[model samples]
Target: MIIRVRDQFDAYSTNTNKVLEAGIDLKTRLFSEGGDSPYANIIAVNSKRVNDPAIVALVKALKTDKTKKFIKEKYKGAVIPAK
Candidate 1:
């Protein structure tokens, strides 16, 4: 009966194995990513740095399939990437 953000439960410090061993179910889908409680996680960039090569590269990397796959594999179903 722990209600919190899906991503929080997937963190390395969450001790998910212990929680599961304690009979806490993690597969229950209570709310979807965009059904009713629509939320977004944003990365804010400095206006002055928007055109910097590093920032451009980072943004480009984030929009790639590799990044999406990494997110899916690392976070499992906890984090959903918006298409």
Candidate 2:
């Protein structure tokens, strides 16, 4: 799965480690104004960005260890989907 970082700030943290530990190979990318892709399973936007409901949902989803582990196991060492 492709995990797109909403911005540079969101991408620059140990938060990705939590995803990595779960087994997914995270691909960080900046959220462009006209960019949208179905391949990105999660879009981790910084709280300071626009208060998008989707981003909020993604953040909530990543809050639990079980969710992280599930994501990790689901994508473990697998090539991220093309966007």
Could you say which candidate leads in lDDT? 1
- Writing each residue's lDDT as its tens digit, candidate 2 over 1-83 gives 22344334434334334556554445542332122434344565666874887776766667667776675576553323223
* TM-score (all chains, Cα) for each model: 0.54, 0.28
| lDDT for position 13 in model 1 | 33
For model 1, what is the alpha-carbon lDDT of residue 49?
Answer: 89
lDDT for each candidate structure: 0.61, 0.49
Question: Which pairs of residues collide in candidate 1?
Answer: none
What candidate 2 gets wrong by more than 4 Å, as runs, is 1-49, 77-83
Model 1 per-residue lDDT at 56: 89
Span of 10 residues, lowest total lDDT, candidate 1: 11-20
